[model samples]
Target: MTAETHGDRQLAVRLGELLGPRHPVAAAAVVTPEGTHVASRGTDADADADFDFEIGSVSKAVTGLLYADALTRGEITTDTRLGELLPLGDAPVARVTLRALSTHRSGLPRLPKSAQPWRRTITLWRNGTNPYGETLAQLLLQTRDVPLGTPRSRYSNLGYELLGHALARAATTTYSELVQQRIATPLELDCFYVPVTADELRPTALHGRSRRGRPRQPWTGEGLGPAGGIRASITSMARFTAAILDGSAPGTAALDPVAPVGGGARIGAAWITVQVKGRPITWHNGGTGGFRSWLGLDRNTGTGAVLLSATAASVDRQGFALLAEHSLSTGNSDSNSNSNSNSNSNSNSNRR
Candidate 1:
């Protein structure tokens, strides 16, 4: 008889504690600028490091990266109005700037008005529904002259959906195609924007479970792809996070905070910045049906991490703990020394 490997036992132990018997196979990964570590708490020979899971709202930050890269390429500025890119017509939302949408200051609601009582009840129960079936044409038709709240950092899926579409419009490509061309290609990530009629996903897509441990429907619908349709393996996310922290990612500019959202949280294009033990940490979390994911970076310490789970359990707390490792004094010392080394190198080169 073959004995279980230490990693497998550890995963079993951790999942046993975190899930308390409700566990559906889960995985977590930590990706620092210099290294990466991954652990699996459940077993599935088919679901190795390459198995992709829906990242939910974490797609917003990915969209933010696309926005920042667009700005870098001089395609559009943050001040660009939504109407300038999309065919919003004379809708009041046409006046909202891409900046406002990226920072969630456009005053758009968390979701469209169409998602109704069923959405509320199902979400509360984690029943999993494809709440985003409205196509781009439908989305534009739904826009009205409804007044919005004052500009501030309020989470808005609708705003991001529009923002992604606008960015794609500016690039003359579909949202998924833009992501693949700009972000995934540069970083060599295996992630993809999964559409609702995704026939290719049947073999790899993991079934999501409701909070009550019942299996739920898969999250699909191409219309909502911009807001929350991307999926990737834990390792792929880790690699992406590592790239962002090191400034190699095209969307690196998205990590810079653009506006404060009170209580010490600042909003970037779509990423949120918070302080942990006095070091700035940029992060975003996502959840859909039975999946949840997180991406975080600490530019000051040149380190970052990602947490991806196949269950709907929020990974925010685990993300915070792992990401905070960079805030420790040791990590800062290494960063300071590296900064000094780089400064000296630059000075010597200048002398020559």
Candidate 2:
């Protein structure tokens, strides 16, 4: 119903065209300074607004929110090191600053090499195994062996995981609790951390599918939730992004670019920044065993978009394209409206 009205069908058509038939089930939304619009595909008779899928690394942005909130409260500074927050022993990562972790510059690898990541990848592809079963404690144990490189833009899931854990420790709570209380509650979002399987998300979790549309294992596990554990609907994300652009969200400081990510792209806390049509856009994307998601915003125009899909194929190019188009549209509409107002006023003066 909501998807059937309010430009939902039009947005859904655009999404469908971008994804084609590969990602049959998805939801996309655009939020402007004016209001929010939502659309969904393959959600026919069995889903509600709360229905959603894993948001993957977009969870990094959530972690970034927690970090920013703490920063504002003087709980932690950008310069705070991991060792000061958690009892990380002598791991090289212990010396890394919170800022570095947030920006993927802590020199940590994408994951602990000892985890046999390649094996896990093969198993996941062949049989849909939940490869991230290692708990936080175990993951910590493996971190000592991770060679810390010079701070640069290396995408590290392990870095965010550690950062989330350390931030939780700083707040005297678990990562899941920290996210719920600090970010979700403050923002009034219905999002859930879903440490493992969430019964609520089950009724609507678009059955995880592979690139070929074969059923794949849903990405649910402990420990990795901090790194990629958030589950939410398009509406939920749309509202959240809207909050960030409107200045009501607590963690938007995370969007402040800290270092160059690559080739003219800069990285904020967990968000990646790039110029789209001459306007700066900060965004992040995620993929699990069976889900793909993206969130982006054009702060210059207070416009944002979120795209979530049940299939593992990426929608990065499409997501960026859509956000760019909307960002440009918002600018053009403002200029055109102003021109029209002036034209009408001049016409009225002549008639008078």
Query: Number of the top candidate by lDDT?
Result: 2
Error of 2 at 151 (Å): 2.4
* Candidate of highest TM-score: 2
lDDT of 2 by residue, 13-123 (tens): 887777777777788889987778888877655445456778887888888878888889888988999989877778787899998898888889888889888888888
Evaluated against the true structure, the overall lDDT of model 2 is 0.75
The estimated TM-scores of all candidates read 0.84, 0.89
Give the Å shift of residue 53 in candidate 2. 0.8
Which segments of candidate 1 are over 4 A away from where they belong?
A: 1-23, 47-49, 117-127, 200-202, 326-352
Query: lDDT of all predictions, in order shown?
Result: 0.67, 0.75
